[model samples]
Target: MKAFFLDAAVTLTLTAAITTMAACVGPGAEAGTVTKGKIYASEAAMDAPLYLYENNHAEEGGKTFSRSRYSDPQGKALVEEEVIYEAGKLKQHTYVQHQTEERGTIDVNDGKVYYVFINAKGTKTGSDKWNDDMLLPDMLGQRIADNWELLNAGENLKVRFLALEVQDNFGFKIFKEGESTFQGKPVVDLAMKATGFFVALAAPSFKFAVEKEAPHRLLKMDGRL
Candidate 1:
């Protein structure tokens, strides 16, 4: 599986597995799962997390839903995002930046993506063609899990990932970096970088560690959250 980071330079570290649910949904609905992770300033100093993230996932009516919240050390909300998917494809994503009061939404429809942003100034909107294989930040983990075999075989894969903040897509290449031990468990290391000329020079490469065993659960990600 392939892993992608959030911003051009930020870093994220997955300290736990997504299946390790921290909470559950209410009655009459499928049980929800919660995964929590920490955001670090850099990989070299993971001694403490600069921020914390929690993702809650649930399924209903053939569709999957996820809500993620990011907060500072004191628990002050920074950003909140919600994503919906159908059959493993993005359906909609909406987020709000509490500090800036910036809100946005990305919707996929009929091979196209529609985006809208609202802030102190006013509302801005745009659209872009949706590529069939385009990946979103929230989909990275699943994509990696789904393509584990190809990655394990040493295949370097190229993918187009949607950058919701810019309402555009960027090219990226994912390759196996090597094998290592993380948190005392054996893991397969993978790395990804921007493929575009200018992006390749400016964007820092990201790394991921996944279990070497079956299911290949993500152990850590060294890049922006």
Candidate 2:
């Protein structure tokens, strides 16, 4: 698939990967299946069985989506996240974490779709514009390949990636090494992360499953990784 890269002058780093060809939906990826990795909305193992899933969206071109942050695990939303889709896949996502005085309205200006900054003044940035998808060629497949290699290697060199529906094409190819129990249920060694944010978490190797029956815990989002 063809992709655009930010000039070296923008972030001063380089990484590459194989991307989806025109947002082709992978086999069996119609529902949400949150898993662990460099970045994603993963199902919590020990917490209140909180779960999140990335599901399939629109088809072809600029399609918009709405995400709601709620007080109930599956109820009335307290906050909303406006997301954009391209070729049936997620292109950009933005949500105001808090409505406190420390926050304000986040506006997407200058034709930019997705945005993020690794710096305080929002100096360092990334995008999800035309040919500017975060996961590059070979990066959005069964095995984590190319480009994102640095993300698993570099220290102090932080990265944020975006991933789509976690049904079959999106859930983890996780395997169980032995029988285990977490919260009185079967648990397995698992990793979780978001696909579209600038945060990486190694979630203390877990064995948790989604219990449409539980709630999600909020992680404190204002500290260094």
- The 10-residue segment with the lowest total lDDT in model 2: 216-225
The residue-level lDDT of candidate 1 at 22 comes to: 13
lDDT of each: 0.67, 0.26
Q: Per-residue alpha-carbon lDDT of model 2 for 32-125, expressed as tens digits?
A: 3222211112223224312221223333234434332322244333333444444444445444433321112222335543334222334333
Estimate TM-scores for all models.
0.81, 0.31
After aligning candidate 2 to the native by TM-score, how far in Å is the CA of 58 from where it should be?
7.8
Candidate RMSDs in order? 6.8, 15.2
Maximum-lDDT candidate: 1
